[model samples]
Target: MKFAKYGSITLITFVLVAGIAIPLSPSPQNWLQFPVIPGLEEKARNILYHVPVAWTTVVAFLVSTYYGFRYLKTRDIDYDIKSVSAAGLGFLFCFLATVTGALWAKFNWGSFWNWDPRETSIFVLLLIYGAYFALRSALETEEKRATLSAVYSMIAGITVPFFIFVMPRIMTGLHPGAKEVADPAAISKAQAIADSAIAVGSKTFADSALATVAQMNVGSAVPVVQLKMSPNMLVIFLLGLLGFTLLFIWLLNVRVRLARMEYERSTHHE
Candidate 1:
């Protein structure tokens, strides 16, 4: 158990250092030089930590919702506890991701709140999950609450993919890759031809061909620049993630033990 706890802390530290700190820092050349999209310079740095956190939280919530469903099916309190714990952690990470994204947006798009489709959708997701917790608390009976919450969680989970991917693309938004808009130079001649084949109206074959040629010329004229990372911030972020992970694991273990003891006492009384 001690080793498991320590290992989880170490892994979390590594993830934070590699994922967040190193990417955010501004100096010490030896760290990896991450590639940025052509026009977005320092702003691209947001991709490293922000994207990871958003996706990680999505995964965490999905797992939590899955356990919620399982609890309903089996009437298992353990599953319910696990579901809530994971959801709580997921919520923290989701909020962090949104804040980081907001910072990036302020720098890149000149506003923190743009009501972009992707941003609005994710914000809605946060609200929905927030309501989930509140609804859980409003009920008096644990079993009834868990079952109903599980059903709601499952329904919400069904919309996750749509909100995360599809909804963002259907509208014009400040978010990247929406509607599959790509720099023509990023595609090969053959790929460009393929893209043109299906292109129509404003998105016509002639337009695509012209855009492709223009993109290639522009790209060739510009030189790529890489960003460097600072060591101190990297270490601090690593330590923070490590500390948080260790604390979480310790709390989880304590919760599990307490639940077990409560069950035993209840059994003895019966």
Candidate 2:
């Protein structure tokens, strides 16, 4: 539909903010300070967009695996291709998610790789998905490869989420929401403030100063600070996102066309 163009524009904007702008913009000096008016801070800013990127990629992978299973059942080569595309996209996002999370951790937790439960789980997910790609390559026959890969995908799918969500809570780790230090309430509240600010704008120098002052005042002089976006950075992020999205769409269309051509050739030969 006509919406595709609009969608491309929106994604480009996001890519600009995430990839280029945020990094160039000034990071909050003290990211951990809680904002008084229920919204403000830098860590919260990262969570707003970075977490979602990671999440979208994870869902993409899962959906790919689902299609892989379907391809095995229906013997549809298209489904197999689609499944691979989704998984490939998923892996890209998962890797991005881990990198972004590492950036967040470095700022908040004082280290990039801490072997925390959350980190470990995601790392394992990366490994398992990597294995999925490896398994696909090891087989020679198209049908056999599809069947075996589908089975492997299903098994990995079942295990990855369990490991990502459930195992972390049960075990001790430095990640947030772990045993003996669970504090979703505080984290959620802080996150809410950050999200609200990011929705309006990113934190600016002035906003940062005001937030710092408000933090020192201890509620007596709480100020309402609005998020500010760097126009240049925003533009750059949008451009990068646009470039990637266009490439993805173009590749998908080309693949579909090739498949159609192959089918027509087979029919003509028959």
Clashes of each: 1, 8
Per-residue lDDT, model 2, residue 240, is: 52
Clash pairs, candidate 2, are 12-238, 13-238, 15-237, 16-237, 16-238, 39-193, 201-227, 202-228
lDDT of 2 at 64: 77
Using lDDT as the measure, the top candidate is 1
RMSD of each: 10.6, 10.7
lDDT of each: 0.62, 0.60
Colliding residue pairs in candidate 1: 27-229
For candidate 2, lDDT tens digit of each residue in 16-51? 455433432234333222232223334645644465
Query: lDDT of model 1 at residue 162?
Result: 85
| Residue range 1-270, candidate 1, lDDT tens digits | 686577766765565555544443233355554433433445554554576567666766787888898897789888887777777777887798789989876554444665667788779778877988999999878687888888888888888788767876664444554444333433344244435444633334344344433444444333222223245434444554555545455555666677667857876998
Candidate 2 lDDT score relative to the true structure: 0.60
User: TM-scores across all candidates?
Assistant: 0.63, 0.60
